[model samples]
Target: MIGTSEIILIFGIVIFWIPVILLIYLSIRYLINRSKKVHEEKTALDILKERYAKGEITKEEFEEIKKTLDSA
Candidate 1:
């Protein structure tokens, strides 16, 4: 049978590593989310610029739309 001190040692090891594991997981998730956001922003800006270049929107309208997208 394990003594009290042995159980405490095991618990301490687990407690110490739990936060490390959680931090790694959170960092990965944050990176993935940030990448998706950047890609979407780039795509939206590209579309807006394309429309402006094609003369679908006036220069003033393009500027306003660009400002809105950038604010997002």
Candidate 2:
């Protein structure tokens, strides 16, 4: 009981929504990855600060390592 026009309309709607769905999915994935990276960087910086506080490394060494971590 389906007409040709209805079939074409369904196809058009699917094509239009496919990319929209893909974009939404990709954006969410990118945001999640970015959030994880930021968390990891902050954790590294906190650990570095803790090491400095514990007297494991000198100020100069802490600064140098912090600079390296930030650059990465």
Candidate 3:
């Protein structure tokens, strides 16, 4: 059988430490999700610009895509 002091310590840890640990875990998870969301929020035009800057697309292709984006 557990002693009274041990029972009190266990209860205190259960009531306080559990929530504290959970809060920390949730906060880290939320921050990671938020960062990923920000990265995924890049627009089509932004991607086009990146491709053009990287020389992955020709000037003609860039202009064509830009015109298409503008018409939309």
Candidate 4:
């Protein structure tokens, strides 16, 4: 048979672990979101560079756009 004190101890342990589990889940989610944002920015920069190389943008336009991306 379990005493009341032992039952309380068990409950405390469970409660203590819940926040740890939530922190790990949130950390993973944050990393994934950060990685996705970085990938999006890299892709945008690559596209801009390609367009400039193809002469789709004039030198002044490319410089202005590149400056904007750099600032971001």
lDDT against the true structure, per candidate, is 0.94, 0.95, 0.97, 0.92
TM-score of each: 0.59, 0.59, 0.66, 0.57
lDDT string, candidate 1, 1-67, tens digits: 9999999999999999999999999999999999999877658888998999999999999999999
Worst 10 residues of 4 by lDDT: 38-47
In candidate 1, clashing pairs total 0
Highest-scoring model, TM-score = 3
Q: Give the per-residue Cα lDDT of candidate 1 at 67.
A: 93
Off by over 4 Å in 3: 1-5, 8-12
> lDDT for model 2, on a 0 to 1 scale?
0.95
For candidate 3, report its TM-score: 0.66
Query: Residue 67 deviation, candidate 3, in Å?
Result: 0.2
Of the two candidates 3 and 4, the one with more favorable TM-score, higher being better, is: 3
Consecutive 10-residue window with the lowest summed lDDT within model 3: 35-44
CA RMSD of all predictions: 6.4, 6.0, 3.1, 5.5
Least well predicted 10-residue stretch by lDDT in candidate 1? 38-47
**Counted clashes in each candidate structure:** 0, 0, 0, 0
